[model samples]
Target: MALDARHWVAPAWGPPEQWRLVETIVPDPGPGEVTIRVRAAGMNPADRKHVAAPRPGVSLPVPIGYEVSGEIVAIGPDTRIGSGEAEVGVEAIAFRVQGGYATALTLAAEKAFRKPAPLSHAQAANLLLAGTTAAEMLERVHARSGDTLLLHGASGAVGVMVLQLAALRGVRVIGTTSEAGSERVRRFGGIPVAYGAGLAERVRALDLPVRAALDAVGTDEAVDVSLALVADRSRIVTIAAPGRAAEHGFLSIAGSQPASAALRDGIRGELVRLADEGLLTVPLSRTYPLTDAREATRFLAREHPGGKLALIP
Candidate 1:
């Protein structure tokens, strides 16, 4: 059955000011692809960055969302699951190479994973990008039990996941967050220190020897404090600053750039396992229907980088 699809598109590059919701016809799944009826789609920082500039290799009038949770509604040849499974966190981030912001999307069969039943549509939607980033960064640094990890932006979705997961691995995680989020950080088994001015002093006051740092925040203070404390530049990874991170002598994980399928799945599986073990969590600040995407994006930016913003279809 053909279904109507609603999608967000930007005819030109700029702010979300260019966003327009249009109705389009559902396309058939091609060979090795299955169409997903997107129940929820999670937003990411890449959405804003990509929208700011039009580039070569990007399809025009394309839809834009990275993480998704949905059901298989149509299948191409040689597939197993046809429909009706509320597969959680079916990622289409690389689908960003194609697109994901639509009521329905055709994804390579190998790219879709069954969402665990323990997660809600929003929870599943929130898992893919942030969760995957956290897991990957931890592994990159070889963070381990009994190690003390200094985390930047520990209250945000990615930061929270990294904090908790590190703790679960027996690593002592010290983190930077606002006073408002202190309880949440503490609950995640991390010691929360305020992010600005004197952050290094506050962190060192925690009385733990730092082994490494993960800068998910991209703040100058994060770089300064982490570098001063950690000593080993190789163990410091920054998710935000691909250009300057290496210049500043730290490792970088450019989520805005291409990541390997193996790298993607490594974090995906670990995040799912963490959720199953009750070790992973996300702060979903709000959800908006697809029609209200502009408002969703604006609210997301102002919510001070905590939790997640999700679009429900």
Candidate 2:
């Protein structure tokens, strides 16, 4: 049987205004994959950036989402769910999925995990990319118990996850944010410091021996401060400032980097475990209907909301 579904797609590279909602056929799972009826799709900056100006060689009419939470409707050969065989009607969350903006999409079975019982569809949908990114950054920096690290942009989704996960590991963090986000950073067990204008001096004034740093903000100030405070450039990793990494002699773990991919893959299951145990979470900034993806992207670009944005399909 064939399935039909509607999805938002970018037919060409341009602004958010260029995206279109179109009806399309939903394909079944192939080998090592499963088909999911998407309930919620999480949005990220990459969603907008990739659509507006897709990477070289990316095909046209590219699907516009990366993560989704849904119910499994069918399974393909060799697919397994957590060490056992997959079953239909299982609620799950998948990350790095293709065409996640659709009502239904097929995803690699290994990339799909059983949704934690306590998480709502929105939270589960929002977890994977940010959680895995946080995990990878920490791994790149070799963060551990008793260490004090500097985190730039601590109030954002990935930053919040890093703060909480670091706290769980007994690592202390000094997090940079705007005045409005300071309290949120503090609540997540980070020492909140305001960003911009002598930011390096501000972090230095704390008088703590900062062992490592992770830059989520990717500003000139963030890169400068991390370089000044952290003795070893290798221990400083930036998710945002990949292009500037070579100039500063630090490591950059942007999506395409081999180290970044390995780190993300290694920690995928651990992130689920952490969420399942209540050790981590994602704050929802807003939810929009699937039809409002354009509005959602514009809102994210303009508002720079503090938490994750999601679309309900």
Best by lDDT, which number? Answer: 2
lDDT of 1 at 254: 59
What stretches of model 1 exceed 4 Å from their correct place? 80-98, 256-261
lDDT of each: 0.75, 0.87
Q: 252 in model 1: Cα distance from truth in Å?
A: 1.0
TM-score of each: 0.90, 0.96
lDDT of 2 by residue, 1-313 (tens): 4478888889999998999989988778888888889999999888888877758779998988999999999998777954256699999999887778879887788888888777889889999899889888898889999999999999998999999899989999999999989989999999999998888888889998899999998998899888888889989999998888988788888766676777787788888888888878888888899999999989988886878888998
Write one digit per residue (lDDT tens) for candidate 1, span 163-237.
877887899888888998888899889988888888888887888899999988787888888789988888999
Stretches of model 2 off by over 4 angstroms after superposition: 82-84
**In angstroms, how far off is 214's CA in candidate 1?**
0.5
Error of 1 at 133 (Å): 0.5
